[model samples]
Target: MSETILEELFIKRSQQKRKASPLNYKERWFVLTQDKLSYYDYDLNKAKRKSLRGFVELEKIKCVETVQPEPNSPPERSYAFQVIYDEGPLYVFAKNDATRGEWIKKLKEKVRFNKDLIQKYHPCFWADGMWQCCQQQVKEAVGCKVLEHKNGVGFSSKNSSRRRPSRKPLPPTPEEEKPGCRPLPPQPPEEPSHSVGMTVIAEYGYTPVTPQDLELRKDEEYTILEMTDANWWKARDNTGREGYIPSNYVVNAGNGLERFDWYCKNMNRSQAENLLRTENKDGGFLVRDSSKAGKYTVSVFTKGGGESSGNSRHYNICTTQQGQFYLAEKHYFNSIPDLINYHQHNAAGMVSRLKYMVSNRAQPPSTAGLGYGIWEIDPLHLKTIRELGNGQFGVVKYGTWMGQHDVAIKMIKEGSMSEDDFIEEAKIMMKLRHENLVQLYGVCTKQRPIYIVTEFLCNGCLLTYLREGQTQHPTTIQLLEMCKDVTEGMAYLESQQYIHRDLAARNCLVDANGTVKVTDFGLSRYVLDDEYTSSAGSKFPIRWSPPEVLLFCRFSSKSDVWAYGVLMWEVYTMGSLPYQRLNNTEIADQVPRGLRLYRPQLANERIYSIMNRCWHDKPDERPTFQELVVIVQDLLYELQ
Candidate 1:
């Protein structure tokens, strides 16, 4: 390749000699180069001891005290070559001398490119002689003590891996046998480390959970908790009172058991907003015009579902050019409980609660069975929905599902995700279902490029709504209600054993009736019920992230709580950006340093107390979403 690489090889060789252990011993030789591209080799043992005796005796040659000693001071050494240029340090591993010498003349005359010689010279971990002879030969020939070596020859570990396959047939590829470029064949006998487990997790609680700590260790028996991201509502114990703890930290008491999701009600409304106005570069108010807010109202529902004929009234609080207030249907709440009930009844042969039913239980429809009805779609025709947003992954288009219903279609970018990642996302979505949580529909992989379909909220994201100004000035009661809604969603998700890697206001949607729905599980992570450290970071966006997420990239639901604390600031400011005083890097730096944004507007005694706890430096110190829900609900009711 380049001469620079070759020169570096020699330097590397010299460095190796210096680093070699056991300082005193015989058989030591060094290649030294002077200016003029000529080099010299000195065998320390062979040199006349007398010639070096005087200099050695004085032990002062390295300093300026030498009145130059003669015979003994200057040791006899063999010349290898002289350096041509004084360009760099005349150190070992320099280029081979180019001086006109016997060896040089012969090398220039018969330059037959030798592949065998190159292989011999090349560094390898498992070559013959364990690279010792090759290393010595190169050192002597080059007359430069380069340090770096690819000493792979004769490595026992390399030999053990090439055993014959006993089970699965080969993939029918000859080139796969190549030594250097071969992929390690799958071997079941090796160990269980190669196996991967798939799982899904939900979000909940005040403290955010993280995925890095969820690795299942083969050594220890792990118990899978029923609730992924659960919460416990109680009073703080500081005054000997029970306090709320996010259900995530509650591990299974029994070993090797899988836990189930915990069910709870009356989730808190005082919740953290996920959007970070300061961090998002492309952020702006899309709902600036109040009068034009009602133009779009899109809803998605499964085909043949009842309750469809009405043009559901929608409302928008966006600012408009004409300053006219037009209300459009922000959301459509269709009932699927009946169909769910029908399926469950057929499968289990029991009239169970329709709300908790699934379609798999339904057997082939019988003549006497109740049939599922179509609510409002014209199956004969197809229609396109509105475009919601765009990002690096792909564009988000609202599309019609089955018929009259609409859904958000997240067209993933080509090359942005691999099949493995998609599978992982799918595994997480299958088990997570909650009112506050975003619902993931079936994926469209029938085509070459796959797209993810999800429930579409008629009203735009909370980010847009907040920018339009408050529909009603958030009285203590209203703020508490919002917080409760958020906590309820988080608590549900957390109990399901999931970590919402990215939590922001932009992901939360509100209907015209003020009903809130959390969306976007693309960054969700499952916390395996085991003792393992989870790495957390703002892999997607850095501004809204907590300190540990930025530095160590490790987080638990506790870290999520830190982010929630910042979100609390956003909600109180009527959607003010967190850490508005600092830049992105500054905010990121401050987070790990245990610095958090303090908002004066949200300094109400109750709200401030909770936000402070949420942003605690020690993740364990953060309040659980369930506890937060209880506190907010109490505050709201008191104000009411």
Candidate 2:
């Protein structure tokens, strides 16, 4: 490392560790060099009288990036940057953006060739034991958002992001039953390209779905051949290979709607409505996901005749066969935001013109875990927001994981289950991702009493939905969709070789959209794989149990199928208890002797027949979950 004739900003000098750090505003002279960064304290009276303070080897630097300033930070210190290395982050204050940029650009050049660069990084400052950006409590949690690098190496080992090899992503093909099943929706028109040939860069890497589909490489540019569908488009890569590509996966060279204002990627219909209504600006509007997947809805709120909040009108942003998006039938645009922009000026056919974007301050939903590889939650980070409820699980509370992510914490009174064993089992559970499963984030076993953390669904229990609220007067299609949600989750669990053991309406949760996800999946196994002991008694759910489960205690997918029948019975009867009139003692004795619940009034002959199949006396005779999904889907399609 040459030390002669180098700019002071080029080198940072000392590695001797010290405790009780000085304030960030303390100015120190940094010596910048090609391979070394050394900083020292110089006497104000004598320029040559300097003491070596601290330094970092540029080769060991992991990331060189700027951070969001804290509240009420001084202007000079506001241009701060962090130089992260094996030791941790080194915070340094710069005079302004120009100086900070210069230092960062030079530092990045020195460490560009360094191995193991992080892809995800927190943009906000880490303070008071929490990340100011995502509120993730873990100091070392993975970045809440993806950090892009021009050079392809963006994975974070600390955050557990791994560079993945290219693999084919088959285009979604919704299955259909034989002869009677509804035909698949018509594919978008293939002829006459919707948009004039335009170029786009892939934001995320993707493999070709079909031979006619082009591969999408991150940051790679391609020319549009045609717009086949809103979701899928035809494009030609640089090599002139023309094929279909997922539209949302690629963006115009400018990096698309990721940072685009007014587009809330994860905001559902209700949340958008609530935000728009709350703002109450006459033309207040926002874009969010539609109830139907892979579509968007424009929610606009307007006040009428002295109304305080006003009514919110939701319009499904429709797509034509040519792939043009439109709010009004005659007017169309190549992109959703383009439509939004146009509508902002002209109402055309809508009740109100698009205006305010309430999402300017809207926070994205927190990731399930504090960060990758963070299972053991530090007790300090967890805080009780409110008591959700107390019942079978014992004192379930609505709490914040790391004082950020909303989590339902189940406080258990008694359990001899070892933390080591549960931790091992939890690894698999955490990786089980399904839209229908109420995801188990992690367990708090650091202290005496164990706490279980799970994803919080806004609309409480499924039983409540069936009895009152939205599902109270659900139509045939609505009821079937809810049933389909449960079956899809159970089918996935069955495919994973995992059994819910206790499958009931009570054990399932409903989201704001009425989508039901199976909860407490594969969790009872920690207590004992085959044996589950709840706070009350043995966890062999009696009313739900088939003869084999009630008689032999033999739990399997088949037994779960039997429970599904009762769950279906509950759904059809609107959360009516099984054996409506009979007591448990009488029903238990009589059920084994071939007694069965009658069909619900909501269930017609066809639906009732399907429920009966699930209640077959022989376990093997019951329909597998996969079969049930198809049957229910087909029935729902017919109803729709």
lDDT of 2 by residue, 1-640 (tens): 4653234332221222344443334557777776577777766667652787676776557688888887997566577778876565677777678878877877776667664354446787766556788775544444544455512344332343222213322122222122332211111113223364887877566655236666777768888877634445778888888777766566675535643567666454445666776677988887876544356778889886768869888888876534678989899899887888899899898887886766633322323344444556766778888887775546888888655577888886564444456666775566566668887777788786778778888888888877885644666666676777888789878766577777889889987545688997655555543335542244666778788766766777778888888888888888888876876567668878998889789888777777777887876556667667656754553452
lDDT of 2 at 406: 77
lDDT of 1 by residue, 552-626 (tens): 666555566666676666677777766767776787777777776664574576677677767766554455564
Candidate 1 segments whose C-alpha is farther than 4 A from its true place: 1-382, 522-540, 600-603
Say which candidate scores most in TM-score. 2
Q: Which candidate tops lDDT?
A: 2
Cα RMSD of predicted structure 1: 29.8
Per-candidate TM equals 0.40, 0.49
